[model samples]
Target: MGLQNITGLFYPSQTLGGPHIDIEDIITSQNVISRVMHSYLGILVPLGLLAGVICVAILIRNKVKHQTLENLDLHLLALVATDITIVFYSFTSKTRPDYLEVSNLSCGVLSWFFNTSYFFSQYLLVLMILILLILDDSKTSQSHLRYVFLTLTLSIVMSVVNVSLLGTYDNLHNITYCQLDPLNARPEYDFTKFFAGFCVPSLVLLIFVILIIIRAREVEMSEKLQAHGVVLCHVPIMFICRLFYNIMLIRRTGLKINAFYMSPREELVLNIAELAVFSGSCIGLIITLALHKPCRQGLKKSLQFLINKCRGKETSNSVI
Candidate 1:
C-alpha cells in the first residue's frame, strides 16, 4: 500500500469515510492545536530552562562546598533535569510548516524519546515521594540510588512498550507532532497508554501521599509542617492534572471520535488537556524551588552573581 493509503487507516471512523478536510485547510485554518502547542512551548521552554540551570548550579555548589546531599536534593535535581529535557524535546517535535514531512521512522524515534522522557519524569516523582515517606533513619544513599535506578529502568521499558504496541508512532495531523496515533488507535492500546502513563503513576503517588499524611498525624508534626509537606510534595495537584488529561483522552478515544472531526470547541478542550500534560511535569520543579531552602538560596545567589558580573563588565566597558 502507498504511504498515504497506509496513513489513512490511523484516523477514527468519523474522519476516514466522512467529509474530507484539505490538508492545506487543516494547516492554514484557525488551528487551535498548533496555537496551543506554541503557547505551551513559549512559556514552558524558558521556565524549564531557568529552573533546570539554577537547580543544576545549586547541586554543583553543594558538592563544591562539601555540603551533605540529601535525598530530596538529589530528587529535585533529577526532576529538574527531566523537565528541561522534555521541554527541549517538545520544541524539537513541534511541526514546521514548510519542512518536508517527516518519515515514519523519524516520527517513531521522536515519539519514543518524547514519551520516555515524559514517563520518566512522572514515575520519578512517584519514586521521590515514596522515598520521602520512608523513615528518615532508614533512608540512605545506597537505598535512594537503588530506587532511582529501578524507576528509570521501569520507565524506559514502559515507554518502549507503549510506543510499540499501544499505538503506531505517527504525527498527529492537526498538531504535526509525533505521538502515538491517537484517533485511529486501538482502544486496547489507548487503555494501555492511559493505564501506564497516568493511572499507575498517579496511583503510586496517592498511596504514598496517604502514608505521608498518616505519618504526619502520628508524629504530631505541627499543622504547619503537615501543610508544608503537602505543598512541597505537590502530589495531589499533579495527580489532579493527570487525571483530568487522562479522562479527556479516554472520553475522546472511547467515544471513537474521528481525529479530524473535532469541532473548534472540542479541539480547544483537547489543547487544554495537552497543556495539562506538559504543565504536570513543571509542578515538581516549581515545588522544589518553593520548598527547598538550599535550592532557593543557591539559585538566588547564582542569579545575583551573574547579574553582578554583567554589571562589572558593562562598567569596565564604559570606563574604557
Candidate 2:
C-alpha cells in the first residue's frame, strides 16, 4: 500500500471495504462524523481549559492565603497544570487541518510532551494516594516535592522511550505523522505503555484505595481522613474517564495487527473515548472543588469578591 493508503486506513472516515459499500453513503457518513468530532472538540476543549485554569488559580490562592499547604494540595496543583497542557496540546494538534505535514522534530516533541504529561499525571495520583497512606507526623513538604520531581523525571524517561520507538519519519513521503507508526513494528512499546502507564498504576491505586477504606472504617475519621476521602472519590472518576481511552487504544492495536477495517461505528466510539479522556481531567478539577472544603470556599470567596467589585464600579458610575 502507498503511504496515502496506509494513512487513510488509520482515519475513521477512510476505511477500506468490499464493493458492496455505497460510495455516496460513505461520503455522507464521513461528513457527519467530521462534524460531530469537530463540534465535540470545540465545546470540550475550551471548557476544559477554562475550568482547569480556574481550579489552578483557586488552589494557588488558597495556598497563599492560608500559608499552610498540604502535600495533597501540591500534587493537585501539579495534576491540574499537567492536564491543562494535555488539553491544549490535544486541541492544537488534533484539530489542525494539516497534521500530516508536521515536521519530524515537531512530531517527536509533541509526542514526547503528550506522553510525559499524561504519564506524570497518572503516577502523581498514585503518589498522592501513597502520601495519604503515610502518617501525618512523618510527612514533610520537602519530601513531597522530591516525590513530584522524581515522578516527573521518570515520566520524561518513559516518554523518551515511547517517542524513540513509536514516532518515525517517512523519508519517501516527506511527511511525519505523529503516532502513525505500525504497532507491529515494535510491539513492546505498546505493551509497555499499556502495562506501565495504565495497568500497573491502576492496580496499585485499587489496592491503596481498599486499604485506605479499611483503615478509615477501623479508626475515627478526622479532617485529614476527610481529605483522603476526596482522593477516594477522585480515584473512581479518573478510572472511569481513562478506561474508555485505554480500551480504544487496545482495539486499535488489535485491528491493526489483524489487518481488519474499522467501521464508522467503531470510529465514533473511539472518538467519544478520546473526548472522555480530556473530559476526565475537567471532571477531576470539579470533584476537587466540590469535595474539598478549602477549594470550594476559596472559589466562592473569589466569585463574591469579583461580584462586589463590579457592583462598586456600577454604583460609582450611576452617581457620576
Candidate 3:
C-alpha cells in the first residue's frame, strides 16, 4: 500500500545497486532539508552516548553500594545497554559521508546491529511493562534475569534473520543516509517487520496504559505519579514519532520515487519527520534521568562527590 511504503519501516532489499548514483550530486546538491536532517543526526549521536554514560555510572554505583541489583535499576541498565548500541550505530552511519559508498561485511553488520538494537529496545520495554504488571518487588530481580536472557537470545536470532533475508543498504539514497530498499520488499517482509517492530509492542503498550488507568481508579495509589510511571509513559512518545516518520516516508514515495524526485516542500516535511525520530530516541534517556528517582538521586550524589573532591584539591594546593 502507498501508506506502508511511505513509512520506510521495512527491511532493506536483497538486491544491490539499482541505478548509478552521482556522488557529486549527493555531496554538493543537498538542499536545506537534507542538510537539516544531517544536522539532527549529528547531534543525536553524541546525545545518546552521553545518556548511556550517565546511566552506566549510576548502575555501577548502585551495584557497589547495594551489593545487588535493584529491580528498577536492573531493567534500566538493560535499556542503557541497548541505547548504547543504537547510539553507536547512529553515530557511525551519520558521521561517515561515504557510508553508502562502502559495501563491506562490517557495514552490513553495523546495519544489522542498528535494526536489532531498535527491536530489542522495543521488546525490552514490553518486557518491563509485563514485569511491572505481573510481579511485585520480591520477584522482580528473578524476572529481570529471565527477561534479559530472552531479549538477548531473541534479538540475536531475529537480527541475523532480518539481515539474511533483507540484505543491507544498496545505494546512497540521499545525502543524509542510505537505507533498505522498499521497492524490493515482499509482502511477508512487511508482516514480519510490522509484527515484530510495531504491532506487538504497540498492543502491549496500550494494554499497559489501560491497566495503569484502571489501577489508579481502583486504588488511589498516591505513589502513582512517581518515577517508574513517568519513565514508562514516556515510551509512547517514541513509538508515535516512529509511526509518524514511517507514514511520511510512505507519503513521500507516493508523491515521487526517491530523493532525486523529492520536491523542496516534500523534502522539508520528510526531514521534519526524521527529526522527530531522533528527538524521540533522545527524549527516552532524558526522561529516565529526569523522572527516575534512583537515577536522579545517584546523579546528585555523584555531582556532590565531585564538588567535594574539587574543594579538597583546592585546600591542599593552598596548604602547599
Candidate 4:
C-alpha cells in the first residue's frame, strides 16, 4: 500500500526507527558514487555504440551479398540491435547532466525501454540456444523469424509488468531516482523480480549451457556447432556481468525498505555493479568479433576491400 507498509513487512524490527546518520555523510557518498558511475558510462557507452555500429554494418553487408542470413546470423543481428538499443538508451537517460530536470514520466519511459531491450536480448539468447539444440538448420532457418517475433512479444509483456512496479521521484536534495514506487513496493513484487528476472533465468541459462557442452562432447564439432559454441560464450558472460548488478538491486531494496544508512563502501559497490551491467554488451560484442569466425572473416574481407580501393585511388592520382 505504501512505503511504511512495505517496510513493515520486511523489516519489522526497523519499523520503529532507523539509526541516525549525518545527512552530509549520505550526500557526500552519493556524490562520489555518481561521479564514478558517470565516468564509467562515459567510456563504455560510446565504445559500445561504435562497436555495435561496426558489427551491424558487417552483418548487413553479409546479408546483402548472400541474399539470406543463417539462423545464427539472424540471432546475432537481433542481439546486436538490442544491445545497441540498451547502450543508446543509457546514453540518453543515465548520462544526463545533473542540472537537467527529469520528470517522472520521462524516467519511467526510459526505464521501460532499457528494461525491455535488456530482457529481450537475454531471452533472445535463450531462444538461440534452444534452437541450436533442438532444431536442424533447415527448420531453424525457415522458422527463426517467427520465433523472434514470439520472443519480442513475450519480452514486451514482461517489461510492462516489470516497469509497473517501479516509480521515479526526487529526493529532498532534488536528486532524481527510480525505485519501487511507494504504492507498488510490495514484498511479493520485490522477491518475484529477484527470482524471476535474475535467479531463475540465470539458472536456466546455466543449465542450457551445460546441455550444449555435453552435446558438443558427444559428437564431432562441425563449423555450425562451432558457431553455436561461440554463441554459447554469451551465457557465462551474461552471468558474470549481471550478477553484481542484481545483488546491488537486492541490497538497495532491503536498505530502502529498512531505511538503513548506506555506507560509502556500499555506495562504491553499487556503482561498480552498475558499471558491470553496462559493460556486458561491450564485452559480449568484443568476444563475438574476436572468436566468431564469420565475423573475423568479414572484417578481413572489408579491410582488404578498403586497402584495394585506396590503392586504386592512389594509382589514378599518380597517372593524372
Q: Write the per-residue lDDT of candidate 4 for residues 1-320, one digit (tens) a residue.
A: 12223242222111222354454555565566577667757776667777677778888888899988888888898998887776665444253212123444555566667677877888888888777776457665558888898999888888778766653322212223332222124444456556756787787787876776677765544444766766888888888888887787788678767766555456556656756766888777777776766777887888899999999999999999
lDDT for residue 271 in candidate 3, whole number 0-100: 49
Stretches of candidate 3 off by over 4 Å are 1-29, 37-43, 95-99, 104-108, 167-177, 180-191, 218-227, 249-275, 318-320
Kindly list the per-residue Cα lDDT of model 3 for residues 1-320, writing each as its tens digit: 01122324321121122244343334332445456657666676566667668877888788998888887788888877776665554444342222243333344455467667767888888777766655456675777688788987887777666565442234323222343323233334444555677677888888986786667544333353353674466567768977876666556445443333443344345546655665666767766776777777888888999999999999999999
Each prediction's RMSD to truth = 5.0, 3.5, 6.7, 5.4
Q: What is the overall TM-score of model 3 with all chains considered together?
A: 0.74
Tell me model 3's lDDT, rounded to 2 decimals.
0.60
Ranking by TM-score: 2, 4, 1, 3
Q: Judging by TM-score, tell me the better candidate of 2 and 4.
A: 2
Which rank order by lDDT, best down to worst?
A: 2, 4, 1, 3
Model 2 accuracy (lDDT, Cα): 0.68
lDDT (tens digit, per residue) of candidate 2 on 59-90: 78777888856777788788879878877666
Residue 218 lDDT, candidate 1, scale 0-100: 58
> Whose TM-score is greatest here?
2
- lDDT for every model? 0.62, 0.68, 0.60, 0.66
Model 2 misplaced regions, further than 4 Å: 1-9, 12-25, 28-32, 63-68, 93-100, 103-105, 167-173, 176-186, 220-222, 317-320
Off by over 4 Å in 1: 1-31, 96-100, 167-177, 180-184, 220-232, 255-264, 304-320
Q: Pick the candidate with the highest lDDT.
A: 2
Cα deviation at 306, candidate 2, in Å, is: 2.0
